[model samples]
Target: MWELRHRGAAARPGGEAASPPREGEAAGGDHETESTSDKETDIDDRYGDLDSRTDSDIPEIPPSLDRTPEILKKALSGLSSRWKNWWIRGILTLTMISLFFLIIYMGSFMLMLLVLSIQVKCFHEIITIGYRVYHSYDLPWFRTLSWYFLLCVNYFFYGETVADYFATFVQREEQLQFLIRYHRFISFALYLAGFCMFVLSLVKKHYRLQFYMFAWTHVTLLITVTQSHLVIQNLFEGMIWFLVPISSVICNDITAYIFGFFFGRTPLIKLSPKKTWEGFIGGFFSTVIFGFIAAYVLSKYQYFVCPVEYRSDVNSFVTECEPSELFQLQSYSLPPFLKAVLRRETVSMYPFQIHSIALSTFASLIGPFGGFFASGFKRAFKIKDFANTIPGHGGIMDRFDCQYLMATFVHVYITSFIRGPNPSKVLQQLLVLQPEQQLNIYKTLKTHLTEKGILQPTLKV
Candidate 1:
């Protein structure tokens, strides 16, 4: 009977011999099996549970929708993968640039719409990545709450924009006036609702993963919506402020690619293996020169140099103002070495042209770090791109990673060195105040101006 029992135990699934216990010890076979199972479950939970698939399960080249033109496909049928990609990228770059010019011609409202669209697409791409990484698509209210938060954030930001730039228009509409008045509170309430929903949706074993995705949604919002908001703010400053910086970044990207494609030998960084020192240096010079010329051309145009403003009289936005000194050409004496090169002692250029140098320099040097950061993020997730939205460029987010960074820099630069207190914006704020408060401000300003002898002391009558 003992030999038969030993043979049956040895034939068990784990293939380990389960010998009968000796007299001094308790039979612990079942306990040992349970303990071993527990250890394996713990290991699985620690390392493999969060992701739905292991590394081997992920494909090396992410599937992308082929968007190549039919003609191009036939024309380049025999090209190698490398040269094929180069042509596709180059062609798409020019197409996007042409579309950009078309949008610029469409005016500021269209530009605002473009920014909003890009923001939504970028948010979607990032949130999609989060869902895939955590396998959280099954989580209740995940997509709903993510989109709800986006709506709330956009409401808050665009509300502030309306209150600032369209105060007159808002004041004319009773419903809008109320909404603008309670905008922040309403925004907070909307967000609080989403937060409560998220808390309610938490599952027993999914608490940690749910929190991870929750944080992921917020970070994605911060990157996409916030930076795009700044881009709009820069747009309102003037199209020149918007266009010059953006064009400089584009110019840098193109020049760098061309230089690198032809002459790249030494690698620039490991995060982006293809980036080259030759590209960096070549791009910097090209971008600076391009910015200078573009700024000069754009600064001369009132439509490009003037701040966008809502005109209640026309019930439309307008760009009409005396060009700021930054846009006006000023003469500067060249350095001794430059005098000989130019054959002139003095050169006249828009002050904004000088500022473009700083903008282009940042776009060339620091803006690329944004792309590198995106590259590292993709590597972490083992993703080749954020999405296959754009055939050759990866996605809208891929093209715009550096643009968002540039937008933030332009906003900061304008605030730090360019912008000052605006009388128009101040008046807009005052217009929304109560009559009594407006009267008080009027009296205070009158008294101050009278004391300064700027306003003829009105006769006591």
Candidate 2:
């Protein structure tokens, strides 16, 4: 059954085998065709037996608390798949949006936890796919090693985050200080242990398949854990940096679906057959506008614009800082063409709102490629969805494939353009240094500043 499924998946959509017989092999084509037909008959008989099995043999879809309400289900029972899917997606989209807002209101810590949870779920979903496809469940220590690697990777990332952002808190705790000081080395050691375990557990017959799953586990970790770490990093920069990009992706997804549902005429891509040019175009404009407005509104609140910081005194994370120039309103003279339309010569806008254009544009334009890549992956595996975690959304990974891509872009954008040398981060590092080393660094900085005329030189007296 597994071989048949894999063979079908390997075949091209054009009804050609993945590897056709060579020209030189034409003499044996008749024999090959006869053998292939015999194999097909055997496959058919096996499939018949499989389908004849009792319902109990089939796995049930995992129950979700957020399944469609029965009343709405009845009302939509008569609708076609297209219309029914539209309603399901729309309703669940709003529900997820509401949950997102609630998490935002709860603050950055909650947001980080949420990201971590999503990362784990995505990792699980992908690893589960590997297990199902390769039948690797019987492999010794494979599951254990996969989870061990996940822990090692997460420990490395979150440890760095704590060391960078919670230096003061770490300083207060001697245990945490030691962990933070050698975090990378510890992380590497942990991973090495897992690696040794994997080597030891390798079976002679399954060596190639075991290595494939090992690569699969690492790739999944790279996608889910590494990208999620970046998302949290963006959040720490400022809630606006995180929220705007994410919300833009969500907006584009919804607006695109709505437009495509109503006006789709031209197909956008082969991987995602349902995507259309109308949706793509409509989504772009809607996302940009939505991002602009969201940036403007979020900029008004210092809480949204301030970088998140860990306060040892307060014993919790805090978002409190002087708003940066990015958030500050600045006046710009309108172009001659637009002056008449706006009936004004100048307009006041937050610079971040201008940056939102790039974010929204990437979210709408390049972001869909992430989804396309995921779709291709699913097609390769002959799966409809990753899992039925969300009633309409398939899995956490399905909804977040584009989000991971967007988070990466946002992190790059901040580092490349917006972020400067952070004095606080430097100070945090300095605080971890020995007293004599800190004094030397302070003296060096003071001397440099004095030479530069930024600080007055003191007399030896």
Candidate 3:
């Protein structure tokens, strides 16, 4: 009879005992089968015994609306969220408006201080970001060098402004006179010192990052300090230069948001996905119209139209000028549609308003590109906004990005078209010259005038 052996095989014909056949013997396949079955059992146990489950045991997820329209969803999305924070936004807006008027009432000096403050804040924000990125590498003197460069740049720019606008006052102060006299040389030496320090502090592996940050600091200074200086230049030209272009941008932003929220359909630019073509077009038209009206109203006030001239006699600022032709009303032929509607031959408008069209056109069309540039910079850096300084308004940089560009345009416009030589400034320079130098300039001027045929009649020794 044949029998299954548990631990040993039957003895061979020689009657010798067979070993236990190395434990598994004839049951090796069965042991492996049991092990696989145990593993399956363990898996089922861990998974809550799936073999015993039924269709009814599965829970159903609630049905959701898969067919919701994107436009409707977008419109609906912000309504609830914005209303939830409406109080904060409202308070912020009121505060901003109040602060804006307060600055206006405070005059050009305060406005200048505000511009400087904002410039410093912007510089701080950008430099801080660079520091955070590069400081981890323990690069030596990176932050110090950045701030040093800022100081050097500000010293140069502000020194020039002081010397230009407050020449009499600066010449009175011995230290100020010295600084003003050698301002460029002083600025260059300071910057060179910082540059040498940067080179000396460079580490073996951090040279590339160090140079990158060096370039970054200079660029930031150019964008923030230089542009802010231009804004101050606008301030000096007149508060209107500061106020109107800024108002245009603010108006465009408000109207654009309102238009976009209600009727924005097509995307305007990929850099700013939320920007829409409808809003852009609406804002442009609205800004142009607003610029014309603001120009009209402001033209009527010497306070708005005249330059901010410092009165050393009274130690105060003054704005007193006969309205220039630029601010005077001129007759404009009405377009056919307007003539038909109004039954008038012409309309009276300030001549500067024509220039406003250019300003407004820039504020509407090209100005937003500044914001777009800022948006790209932020995206590249993976930042949401420059900072959270102004509550709902992101940061000072965020608010002033387009203003800087507008400032540049206004400055260029004034220099190119509106500016004329100031007799007071010319006389100040003449008074500062040596006696011989002054006499030479007079003789040169007299000779040149004598050469002109028109001046020959009036020529006298």
| Maximum-lDDT candidate | 1
Provide C-alpha RMSD values for all models, in order: 8.2, 11.9, 18.8
Comparing 1 with 2 on lDDT, the higher-scoring candidate is: 1
User: What's the TM-score of each model vs. the native?
Assistant: 0.86, 0.84, 0.78
Error of 2 at 399 (Å): 0.6
Q: Mind giving the per-residue lDDT tens digits that candidate 3 earns over 232-337?
A: 8888887778888989998887788668767899999999898999999999999999998888888889998888877766887788888678888899999999
lDDT of each: 0.86, 0.85, 0.77
Candidate 1 per-residue lDDT, tens place, 47-102, comes to: 44444545566445445577777898888889998899999898888889899999
Candidate 1's TM-score reads: 0.86
Candidate 1: segments with Cα more than 4 A from true spot: 1-62
**Cα deviation of 41 in candidate 2 (Å)?**
31
| TM-score quality measure for candidate 3 | 0.78
Clashes of each: 0, 0, 0
Off by over 4 Å in 3: 1-79, 85-87, 443-461
Q: What ranking emerges by lDDT with the best candidate at the front?
A: 1, 2, 3
Model 2 scores what on Cα lDDT? Answer: 0.85
Better of 2 and 3 by TM-score: 2
Question: What is the alpha-carbon lDDT for the whole of candidate 3?
Answer: 0.77
